[model samples]
Target: MVTRIAKCTCGQLQITVEGEPLGVGVCHCFACQSRTGSVFAALAAFGPGYRVTGRATDYVRTGDQGAKFRFRFCPVCGTNLFHTEEGEDNRSVGVAVGAFADPDFPPPRDSVYDCRRHRWVQLPEGITVYDKDPE
Candidate 1:
């Protein structure tokens, strides 16, 4: 199994993910835009049990679909880290690519929320595009 390890700016926090990501994408929804403070939010989805170290601050918000999403960030530098479904039973986690210490991370496999994407943002060709999360 391939695993990637990431360390936060303070060096006190560590995140480790086993195996390649299940999926990678960017979200252009208003909520994602606001949370990321950018036109879109990029994420790498991983299976359950990925390990995260150090203390993280969490913020929970309800999506337009009424599903609750929880975001976890480094408390010190306020760097967005990962997001997860609200309930403890949920098994997937989405890690922010920007938080990776490696400079050679792969690009996203898809882009989502095109309906809310800015007119100036141009996505690469052939990648999957979705008005919202893929059905």
Candidate 2:
């Protein structure tokens, strides 16, 4: 298992990953774009049990599915760091790509919520794009 580390822009926060990410993707839902203050959000999904260090402020809100979504950010620098589903036994964590110390991180393997995707954005072909969560 290769270990990866990321530090927040302010240099006070650090995130470490024990192995390769479980998945990578971009989200285009209106709520996501609005929360991220961008056209879309890039994320690297990981399995449960990874550890994060340093203090982060959490913002919890109901998602499109009515499930609680929690976002963690640096209170001082306002750097968005992590996102997780708020419930017991939810086995996923999303690391914000921008928070990575490496600038050459690869692009996501998918783009989700394409139905709400901005008209000017063109996603890669043949990726697992979804209009919503596959259920």
Candidate 3:
């Protein structure tokens, strides 16, 4: 099993997860863009086999489809390190792929909300593209 460490810019918050992510994807929703200050947000999802360290601040928001998410960020640096879907029984978590700062980190396998994706932005080949979040 491979272990990965993702941390905030200020190093105040971190998460350690064992093994590869269940899925890696990118989101182009306006909310994601706003949260990341980028055209899109890339994240890796992990199961319960993970541990979190340090302190973080939470900002809860509802998605377009009405699913609520609790985004966690470093209090010192305000780095949006991770987020979790609310009302779900599973303890799955989505960690910002950029937080790892690993140049070789895996590319996103899925792309959501392509309608909102920037016109100049092009995804890699062989990726699953969705006009919107799949139901």
Candidate 4:
């Protein structure tokens, strides 16, 4: 089983996920950019086979489509570790790829919110692009 660990900057919070992610994606929406403090956010979605350790604070926000998402971050380091769709049971968790700090981690297979993507940002070749979240 392939295992990957993603953690906050201060190591106060961490998540260990077994096997590969369900999907990897990049988002250029304003909300994502703001949350990551970058031009885009790269994330990987994992199934329920994962373990989380340490203390975290939660912030819930409604998406453009009105779906609520709960973001969890380390209170000590303030690293947004992961997020999940609200009101879902055992749904896939979105983990910040940067938190893993692995250069060999898989690249994003899809890009969302292309309308907001910076003009200078060039996505990987053959990546699926979406103007907004795919339904």
Of the candidates shown, which would achieve the greatest lDDT relative to the real structure? 4
TM-score of each: 0.89, 0.88, 0.97, 0.97
- Comparing 2 with 4 on lDDT, the higher-scoring candidate is 4
Q: What local lDDT does model 3 show for residue 25?
A: 98
**Clashes per candidate (backbone, < 3 Å):** 0, 0, 0, 0
**Tens-digit per-residue lDDT, 1-135, candidate 4:** 899999999998999998888999999999999999999999999999789999999999999999999999999989999999998787889999999999999999999999999999999999999999996
Residue 70 C-alpha lDDT in model 4: 94
Error of 2 at 18 (Å): 1.1
TM-score (C-alpha, index-matched) for candidate 1: 0.89
User: How many clashes in candidate 1?
Assistant: 0
Which parts of model 1 are misplaced by more than 4 Å?
Answer: 88-90
User: Which pairs clash inside model 4?
Assistant: none
Across residues 1-135, which tens digit of lDDT does each residue of candidate 3 receive?
899999999898999988888999999999999999999999999999789999989999999889999999999999999999998888899999988889998899999999999999989999999999996
User: Which regions of candidate 3 are displaced past 4 Å?
Assistant: none
